[model samples]
Target: MRRVLLCLALFFASPLLANSKTLFLNGVYAATYGDIAWDKGDWRGSNFSAIRLKAGIQVVRIDFVSLTLGFQKVGFYSGMHKWSGDNDIGFDYRGPVLELHLFPDAPFGFSFAGATGTGYSYLTSASQYHYSSCEGCKIDAERSALKVGEFTAYVTYKISSQLEILAGAGTRSVKGEIDYDVDRGGVHSWEKGDVDSWKESNTMVLLGLRGSTL
Candidate 1:
Protein backbone atom coordinates (compact mmCIF):
# COMPACT_ATOMS: atom_id res chain seq x y z
CA MET A 1 0.00 0.00 0.00
CA ARG A 2 2.28 2.65 -1.30
CA ARG A 3 5.21 1.18 0.59
CA VAL A 4 3.16 1.03 3.76
CA LEU A 5 2.06 4.64 3.48
CA LEU A 6 5.58 5.83 3.01
CA CYS A 7 6.47 3.90 6.12
CA LEU A 8 3.68 5.59 7.98
CA ALA A 9 4.74 9.12 7.09
CA LEU A 10 8.34 8.49 8.07
CA PHE A 11 6.98 6.83 11.18
CA PHE A 12 5.35 9.92 12.58
CA ALA A 13 7.87 12.29 11.09
CA SER A 14 9.38 15.05 13.23
CA PRO A 15 12.99 14.63 14.12
CA LEU A 16 15.35 14.74 11.17
CA LEU A 17 18.15 16.32 13.12
CA ALA A 18 16.11 17.66 15.98
CA ASN A 19 18.58 20.39 16.98
CA SER A 20 22.33 20.65 16.73
CA LYS A 21 24.40 22.58 14.27
CA THR A 22 26.72 24.74 16.26
CA LEU A 23 29.26 24.68 13.45
CA PHE A 24 28.37 21.41 11.74
CA LEU A 25 28.17 21.50 8.00
CA ASN A 26 27.45 17.83 7.39
CA GLY A 27 27.19 17.27 3.66
CA VAL A 28 27.77 13.65 2.73
CA TYR A 29 27.50 11.62 -0.43
CA ALA A 30 27.69 7.85 -1.01
CA ALA A 31 27.65 4.88 -3.44
CA THR A 32 29.34 1.55 -2.86
CA TYR A 33 29.68 -2.09 -3.85
CA GLY A 34 31.37 -5.19 -2.44
CA ASP A 35 32.59 -8.77 -2.76
CA ILE A 36 35.72 -10.76 -2.01
CA ALA A 37 34.24 -11.91 1.27
CA TRP A 38 37.68 -13.47 1.69
CA ASP A 39 39.91 -14.81 -1.04
CA LYS A 40 43.30 -14.63 0.56
CA GLY A 41 42.97 -10.92 -0.30
CA ASP A 42 43.55 -11.31 -3.99
CA TRP A 43 40.19 -9.57 -4.59
CA ARG A 44 37.90 -9.72 -7.62
CA GLY A 45 35.22 -12.07 -6.34
CA SER A 46 33.39 -10.48 -9.23
CA ASN A 47 33.59 -6.85 -8.11
CA PHE A 48 34.07 -4.76 -4.99
CA SER A 49 33.23 -1.39 -6.52
CA ALA A 50 33.32 1.40 -4.00
CA ILE A 51 32.64 5.03 -4.89
CA ARG A 52 32.26 6.64 -1.51
CA LEU A 53 32.74 10.40 -1.33
CA LYS A 54 32.02 11.07 2.27
CA ALA A 55 31.47 14.37 4.10
CA GLY A 56 31.08 15.65 7.60
CA ILE A 57 32.35 19.03 6.58
CA GLN A 58 35.13 18.85 9.16
CA VAL A 59 32.62 19.11 11.95
CA VAL A 60 32.35 20.20 15.56
CA ARG A 61 29.22 19.46 17.54
CA ILE A 62 29.54 19.22 21.30
CA ASP A 63 26.22 17.90 22.48
CA PHE A 64 26.37 14.31 21.31
CA VAL A 65 29.89 14.10 19.91
CA SER A 66 30.61 14.85 16.28
CA LEU A 67 34.19 15.57 15.32
CA THR A 68 34.36 14.89 11.66
CA LEU A 69 36.67 15.52 8.74
CA GLY A 70 35.79 13.16 5.95
CA PHE A 71 36.91 11.48 2.75
CA GLN A 72 37.20 7.85 1.53
CA LYS A 73 37.78 6.41 -1.89
CA VAL A 74 38.39 2.89 -3.23
CA GLY A 75 38.79 2.39 -6.93
CA PHE A 76 39.12 -0.22 -9.62
CA TYR A 77 39.39 -0.33 -13.37
CA SER A 78 36.58 0.57 -15.75
CA GLY A 79 38.57 2.11 -18.54
CA MET A 80 42.07 2.98 -19.71
CA HIS A 81 42.80 -0.24 -21.55
CA LYS A 82 42.72 -3.95 -20.72
CA TRP A 83 40.31 -3.90 -23.62
CA SER A 84 38.26 -0.75 -22.87
CA GLY A 85 37.80 -2.08 -19.32
CA ASP A 86 40.48 -3.42 -17.07
CA ASN A 87 40.72 -5.91 -14.26
CA ASP A 88 43.04 -8.79 -13.74
CA ILE A 89 43.64 -7.42 -10.30
CA GLY A 90 43.19 -3.68 -9.83
CA PHE A 91 43.16 -1.21 -6.96
CA ASP A 92 43.25 2.47 -5.99
CA TYR A 93 42.45 4.62 -3.01
CA ARG A 94 42.32 8.36 -2.29
CA GLY A 95 42.05 9.40 1.35
CA PRO A 96 41.77 11.88 4.20
CA VAL A 97 39.27 10.78 6.78
CA LEU A 98 38.21 11.14 10.39
CA GLU A 99 34.84 10.54 12.00
CA LEU A 100 33.15 10.33 15.35
CA HIS A 101 29.41 10.58 15.49
CA LEU A 102 27.14 9.12 18.12
CA PHE A 103 23.40 9.54 18.44
CA PRO A 104 23.10 12.37 15.91
CA ASP A 105 19.56 13.06 17.02
CA ALA A 106 17.76 9.85 16.40
CA PRO A 107 14.32 9.06 14.97
CA PHE A 108 14.73 6.26 12.49
CA GLY A 109 18.00 8.11 12.05
CA PHE A 110 20.25 5.51 13.65
CA SER A 111 23.77 6.91 13.38
CA PHE A 112 27.05 5.32 14.33
CA ALA A 113 30.50 6.08 12.96
CA GLY A 114 34.18 5.22 12.98
CA ALA A 115 36.47 5.89 10.05
CA THR A 116 40.18 5.99 9.23
CA GLY A 117 42.33 6.81 6.23
CA THR A 118 45.65 6.90 4.39
CA GLY A 119 45.75 7.57 0.68
CA TYR A 120 46.91 6.65 -2.82
CA SER A 121 47.09 3.16 -4.37
CA TYR A 122 46.77 2.78 -8.10
CA LEU A 123 47.70 -0.20 -10.28
CA THR A 124 46.37 -1.06 -13.72
CA SER A 125 47.45 -3.62 -16.28
CA ALA A 126 46.65 -6.27 -18.90
CA SER A 127 48.24 -3.94 -21.44
CA GLN A 128 48.35 -6.44 -24.26
CA TYR A 129 50.23 -8.97 -22.15
CA HIS A 130 53.46 -7.07 -22.83
CA TYR A 131 53.12 -7.79 -26.54
CA SER A 132 53.22 -11.55 -26.03
CA SER A 133 56.99 -11.61 -25.43
CA CYS A 134 58.10 -8.29 -26.90
CA GLU A 135 57.25 -8.98 -30.53
CA GLY A 136 56.52 -5.23 -30.70
CA CYS A 137 57.33 -2.49 -28.20
CA LYS A 138 56.21 1.07 -27.43
CA ILE A 139 53.31 0.14 -25.14
CA ASP A 140 53.75 1.90 -21.78
CA ALA A 141 50.68 0.88 -19.78
CA GLU A 142 51.95 0.28 -16.28
CA ARG A 143 50.75 2.66 -13.62
CA SER A 144 51.81 2.45 -9.97
CA ALA A 145 51.55 4.31 -6.69
CA LEU A 146 50.77 2.49 -3.49
CA LYS A 147 49.99 2.90 0.22
CA VAL A 148 46.49 2.44 1.59
CA GLY A 149 44.68 1.92 4.87
CA GLU A 150 41.00 2.22 5.65
CA PHE A 151 38.55 1.32 8.37
CA THR A 152 34.81 1.83 8.25
CA ALA A 153 31.43 1.50 9.94
CA TYR A 154 28.38 3.56 9.26
CA VAL A 155 24.58 3.23 9.23
CA THR A 156 22.47 6.30 8.83
CA TYR A 157 18.91 7.20 7.95
CA LYS A 158 17.06 10.46 8.48
CA ILE A 159 15.18 10.81 5.20
CA SER A 160 13.79 14.24 5.74
CA SER A 161 14.18 17.81 7.02
CA GLN A 162 17.07 18.27 4.62
CA LEU A 163 17.56 14.60 3.81
CA GLU A 164 19.83 11.83 5.06
CA ILE A 165 19.58 8.21 4.03
CA LEU A 166 22.74 6.17 3.77
CA ALA A 167 23.74 2.56 3.72
CA GLY A 168 27.11 1.12 4.73
CA ALA A 169 29.80 -1.54 4.83
CA GLY A 170 33.58 -1.34 4.29
CA THR A 171 37.09 -2.59 3.78
CA ARG A 172 39.94 -1.26 1.65
CA SER A 173 43.41 -2.20 2.72
CA VAL A 174 45.56 -2.02 -0.41
CA LYS A 175 49.19 -1.94 0.62
CA GLY A 176 52.47 -0.81 -0.99
CA GLU A 177 55.47 -1.74 -3.11
CA ILE A 178 55.73 -2.79 -6.73
CA ASP A 179 58.95 -1.46 -8.17
CA TYR A 180 59.53 -3.59 -11.23
CA ASP A 181 60.42 -2.86 -14.83
CA VAL A 182 59.29 -6.34 -15.94
CA ASP A 183 60.58 -5.82 -19.43
CA ARG A 184 58.63 -2.53 -19.91
CA GLY A 185 56.87 -3.64 -23.06
CA GLY A 186 53.72 -2.91 -21.08
CA VAL A 187 55.60 -1.26 -18.20
CA HIS A 188 55.09 -3.72 -15.30
CA SER A 189 54.28 -7.40 -15.04
CA TRP A 190 53.00 -9.38 -12.11
CA GLU A 191 54.23 -12.82 -13.13
CA LYS A 192 53.28 -13.32 -9.48
CA GLY A 193 56.85 -13.90 -8.44
CA ASP A 194 57.50 -10.84 -6.28
CA VAL A 195 56.75 -7.24 -7.13
CA ASP A 196 58.32 -6.22 -3.84
CA SER A 197 55.32 -7.81 -2.18
CA TRP A 198 51.87 -6.74 -3.33
CA LYS A 199 48.64 -6.70 -1.39
CA GLU A 200 44.87 -6.29 -1.36
CA SER A 201 42.12 -6.42 1.27
CA ASN A 202 38.94 -5.62 -0.53
CA THR A 203 35.34 -5.96 0.66
CA MET A 204 33.01 -3.01 0.36
CA VAL A 205 29.39 -1.97 0.06
CA LEU A 206 27.79 1.45 0.49
CA LEU A 207 24.78 3.55 -0.48
CA GLY A 208 24.42 7.27 0.15
CA LEU A 209 22.82 10.69 0.44
CA ARG A 210 23.36 13.64 2.79
CA GLY A 211 22.19 17.23 3.04
CA SER A 212 22.09 19.66 5.89
CA THR A 213 22.18 23.44 6.35
CA LEU A 214 21.72 25.62 9.35
Candidate 2:
Protein backbone atom coordinates (compact mmCIF):
# COMPACT_ATOMS: atom_id res chain seq x y z
CA MET A 1 0.00 0.00 0.00
CA ARG A 2 2.82 2.45 0.88
CA ARG A 3 4.71 1.72 -2.33
CA VAL A 4 1.61 2.32 -4.48
CA LEU A 5 0.99 5.75 -2.90
CA LEU A 6 4.60 6.87 -3.49
CA CYS A 7 4.47 5.84 -7.18
CA LEU A 8 1.23 7.79 -7.76
CA ALA A 9 2.71 11.02 -6.32
CA LEU A 10 5.73 10.83 -8.63
CA PHE A 11 3.54 10.26 -11.68
CA PHE A 12 1.59 13.51 -11.23
CA ALA A 13 4.72 15.53 -10.47
CA SER A 14 6.42 14.23 -13.58
CA PRO A 15 3.62 15.61 -15.80
CA LEU A 16 3.96 19.15 -14.37
CA LEU A 17 7.71 19.15 -14.94
CA ALA A 18 7.43 17.84 -18.48
CA ASN A 19 4.69 20.31 -19.41
CA SER A 20 7.12 23.23 -19.59
CA LYS A 21 6.77 23.11 -23.39
CA THR A 22 3.64 24.56 -25.02
CA LEU A 23 2.26 25.15 -28.52
CA PHE A 24 -0.10 28.00 -29.40
CA LEU A 25 -2.09 29.20 -32.42
CA ASN A 26 -2.39 32.89 -33.18
CA GLY A 27 -4.43 34.97 -35.65
CA VAL A 28 -3.84 38.59 -36.71
CA TYR A 29 -5.99 41.11 -38.58
CA ALA A 30 -4.38 44.11 -40.30
CA ALA A 31 -5.49 47.03 -42.45
CA THR A 32 -3.52 49.30 -44.81
CA TYR A 33 -5.24 52.38 -46.27
CA GLY A 34 -3.69 55.41 -47.95
CA ASP A 35 -3.72 57.62 -51.00
CA ILE A 36 -1.48 58.23 -54.02
CA ALA A 37 -0.38 61.60 -55.46
CA TRP A 38 1.34 62.57 -58.72
CA ASP A 39 3.04 65.76 -59.99
CA LYS A 40 -0.40 67.06 -61.05
CA GLY A 41 -1.87 66.34 -57.58
CA ASP A 42 -4.02 63.41 -58.72
CA TRP A 43 -4.98 61.53 -55.57
CA ARG A 44 -6.85 58.24 -55.00
CA GLY A 45 -7.71 56.34 -51.80
CA SER A 46 -6.94 52.62 -51.40
CA ASN A 47 -7.13 50.24 -48.46
CA PHE A 48 -6.82 46.46 -47.83
CA SER A 49 -7.46 44.01 -45.00
CA ALA A 50 -5.48 40.80 -44.38
CA ILE A 51 -5.44 37.77 -42.11
CA ARG A 52 -2.45 35.75 -40.84
CA LEU A 53 -1.74 32.43 -39.14
CA LYS A 54 1.19 31.96 -36.78
CA ALA A 55 2.84 29.16 -34.78
CA GLY A 56 5.37 29.72 -31.99
CA ILE A 57 8.00 27.77 -30.12
CA GLN A 58 9.17 28.64 -26.60
CA VAL A 59 12.87 27.71 -26.41
CA VAL A 60 13.18 28.80 -22.80
CA ARG A 61 10.38 29.41 -20.25
CA ILE A 62 11.94 29.47 -16.83
CA ASP A 63 11.98 32.40 -14.32
CA PHE A 64 11.39 34.88 -17.16
CA VAL A 65 10.48 33.57 -20.62
CA SER A 66 13.52 34.08 -22.84
CA LEU A 67 13.07 33.43 -26.58
CA THR A 68 10.29 32.70 -29.09
CA LEU A 69 10.34 32.28 -32.87
CA GLY A 70 7.40 32.11 -35.30
CA PHE A 71 6.32 32.01 -38.94
CA GLN A 72 3.32 33.81 -40.46
CA LYS A 73 1.59 34.14 -43.82
CA VAL A 74 -0.68 37.01 -44.92
CA GLY A 75 -2.98 37.39 -47.92
CA PHE A 76 -4.77 40.47 -49.27
CA TYR A 77 -7.76 41.15 -51.55
CA SER A 78 -7.26 43.01 -54.81
CA GLY A 79 -9.51 42.66 -57.82
CA MET A 80 -10.57 44.62 -60.88
CA HIS A 81 -12.89 47.60 -60.41
CA LYS A 82 -13.72 48.29 -64.06
CA TRP A 83 -12.73 47.03 -67.49
CA SER A 84 -12.43 49.28 -70.52
CA GLY A 85 -11.19 46.77 -73.10
CA ASP A 86 -9.28 43.63 -72.15
CA ASN A 87 -7.50 46.10 -69.82
CA ASP A 88 -8.50 46.20 -66.13
CA ILE A 89 -7.16 47.72 -62.88
CA GLY A 90 -6.90 45.14 -60.11
CA PHE A 91 -4.75 44.15 -57.09
CA ASP A 92 -3.40 40.92 -55.49
CA TYR A 93 -0.83 40.45 -52.71
CA ARG A 94 0.89 37.87 -50.44
CA GLY A 95 3.48 38.12 -47.63
CA PRO A 96 5.63 35.70 -45.61
CA VAL A 97 7.50 36.49 -42.36
CA LEU A 98 9.89 35.34 -39.65
CA GLU A 99 9.75 36.89 -36.16
CA LEU A 100 11.56 36.91 -32.79
CA HIS A 101 10.13 37.97 -29.44
CA LEU A 102 11.75 39.07 -26.15
CA PHE A 103 10.05 39.69 -22.79
CA PRO A 104 11.33 41.76 -19.83
CA ASP A 105 9.80 42.09 -16.38
CA ALA A 106 9.72 45.42 -14.48
CA PRO A 107 9.80 46.07 -10.76
CA PHE A 108 6.44 47.85 -10.76
CA GLY A 109 4.68 44.56 -11.60
CA PHE A 110 4.13 45.34 -15.30
CA SER A 111 5.57 43.15 -18.08
CA PHE A 112 6.78 44.28 -21.50
CA ALA A 113 7.94 42.62 -24.71
CA GLY A 114 9.25 43.63 -28.17
CA ALA A 115 9.06 41.82 -31.50
CA THR A 116 10.99 42.35 -34.75
CA GLY A 117 10.87 40.55 -38.08
CA THR A 118 11.48 40.53 -41.85
CA GLY A 119 8.97 39.80 -44.59
CA TYR A 120 8.59 39.72 -48.38
CA SER A 121 5.57 40.79 -50.40
CA TYR A 122 4.41 40.41 -54.00
CA LEU A 123 1.77 42.45 -55.89
CA THR A 124 0.20 42.36 -59.37
CA SER A 125 -2.19 44.72 -61.18
CA ALA A 126 -3.98 44.89 -64.53
CA SER A 127 -5.60 47.79 -66.44
CA GLN A 128 -7.59 48.39 -69.64
CA TYR A 129 -9.23 51.34 -71.43
CA HIS A 130 -11.32 52.30 -74.50
CA TYR A 131 -12.11 55.57 -76.33
CA SER A 132 -15.08 57.62 -75.06
CA SER A 133 -16.64 57.69 -78.60
CA CYS A 134 -15.00 54.47 -80.04
CA GLU A 135 -16.25 50.86 -79.91
CA GLY A 136 -14.60 47.35 -80.13
CA CYS A 137 -11.26 48.75 -78.80
CA LYS A 138 -10.17 45.34 -77.44
CA ILE A 139 -6.99 45.16 -75.33
CA ASP A 140 -5.23 42.61 -73.09
CA ALA A 141 -2.88 44.27 -70.60
CA GLU A 142 -0.85 42.94 -67.65
CA ARG A 143 2.23 43.93 -65.66
CA SER A 144 5.19 42.02 -64.24
CA ALA A 145 5.10 41.31 -60.51
CA LEU A 146 6.33 44.04 -58.10
CA LYS A 147 8.10 42.77 -55.01
CA VAL A 148 9.29 44.43 -51.75
CA GLY A 149 11.01 43.72 -48.45
CA GLU A 150 9.59 44.85 -45.10
CA PHE A 151 10.50 45.10 -41.39
CA THR A 152 8.27 45.59 -38.35
CA ALA A 153 8.39 46.06 -34.53
CA TYR A 154 5.83 46.15 -31.72
CA VAL A 155 5.28 46.45 -27.92
CA THR A 156 3.35 43.70 -26.14
CA TYR A 157 1.51 42.90 -22.87
CA LYS A 158 0.56 39.73 -21.02
CA ILE A 159 -2.92 40.02 -19.48
CA SER A 160 -2.79 36.55 -18.00
CA SER A 161 -1.19 33.13 -18.33
CA GLN A 162 -3.41 32.30 -21.32
CA LEU A 163 -3.82 35.71 -23.01
CA GLU A 164 -1.42 38.21 -24.64
CA ILE A 165 -1.82 41.40 -26.73
CA LEU A 166 0.35 43.74 -28.83
CA ALA A 167 0.37 47.07 -30.71
CA GLY A 168 2.99 48.36 -33.20
CA ALA A 169 4.00 49.65 -36.67
CA GLY A 170 6.24 48.75 -39.67
CA THR A 171 7.52 49.76 -43.17
CA ARG A 172 8.32 48.27 -46.57
CA SER A 173 10.87 49.38 -49.21
CA VAL A 174 10.13 48.26 -52.79
CA LYS A 175 12.56 47.60 -55.67
CA GLY A 176 11.38 46.45 -59.11
CA GLU A 177 10.46 47.41 -62.66
CA ILE A 178 7.31 49.54 -63.24
CA ASP A 179 6.47 47.84 -66.53
CA TYR A 180 3.03 48.21 -68.15
CA ASP A 181 1.35 47.04 -71.37
CA VAL A 182 -1.01 49.27 -73.37
CA ASP A 183 -3.00 49.12 -76.65
CA ARG A 184 -2.47 52.67 -77.91
CA GLY A 185 -0.07 51.65 -80.71
CA GLY A 186 -0.80 47.92 -80.65
CA VAL A 187 0.79 47.21 -77.21
CA HIS A 188 3.81 49.48 -76.58
CA SER A 189 6.39 48.29 -74.01
CA TRP A 190 9.07 50.04 -71.90
CA GLU A 191 11.45 48.88 -69.15
CA LYS A 192 10.85 51.54 -66.49
CA GLY A 193 13.57 50.23 -64.17
CA ASP A 194 12.74 51.59 -60.68
CA VAL A 195 11.12 54.91 -61.52
CA ASP A 196 9.72 55.79 -58.09
CA SER A 197 7.44 52.90 -57.11
CA TRP A 198 3.94 53.50 -55.75
CA LYS A 199 1.90 52.59 -52.62
CA GLU A 200 4.52 51.30 -50.11
CA SER A 201 6.31 52.43 -46.92
CA ASN A 202 3.36 53.26 -44.67
CA THR A 203 2.84 53.25 -40.88
CA MET A 204 0.53 50.55 -39.43
CA VAL A 205 -0.98 49.47 -36.11
CA LEU A 206 -1.11 45.84 -34.84
CA LEU A 207 -3.46 44.24 -32.31
CA GLY A 208 -3.12 40.52 -31.44
CA LEU A 209 -4.47 38.06 -28.84
CA ARG A 210 -2.99 34.62 -28.00
CA GLY A 211 -4.19 31.72 -25.85
CA SER A 212 -2.65 28.41 -24.76
CA THR A 213 -2.55 25.68 -22.14
CA LEU A 214 0.06 25.97 -19.41
TM-score winner: 2
CA lDDT of each candidate? 0.44, 0.35
**Model 1 lDDT per residue over 1-214, tens place:** 3533443344223224233333335533221111111111234233534334444443465675555564544442331122223455454454566665555556344344444444433334544232344434433333345666655566665666555665656565655554323545546553322234456678655665555321
Best by lDDT: 1
TM-score of each predicted structure versus truth: 0.30, 0.44
Error of 1 at 123 (Å): 4.6
lDDT (C-alpha) at residue 5 in model 2: 43
TM-score of 1: 0.30
Which residue pairs clash in candidate 1? Answer: none
State the lDDT of candidate 2 residue by residue for 156-207, as single tens digits.
Answer: 5557543445455565444433443434456454323223344444444445
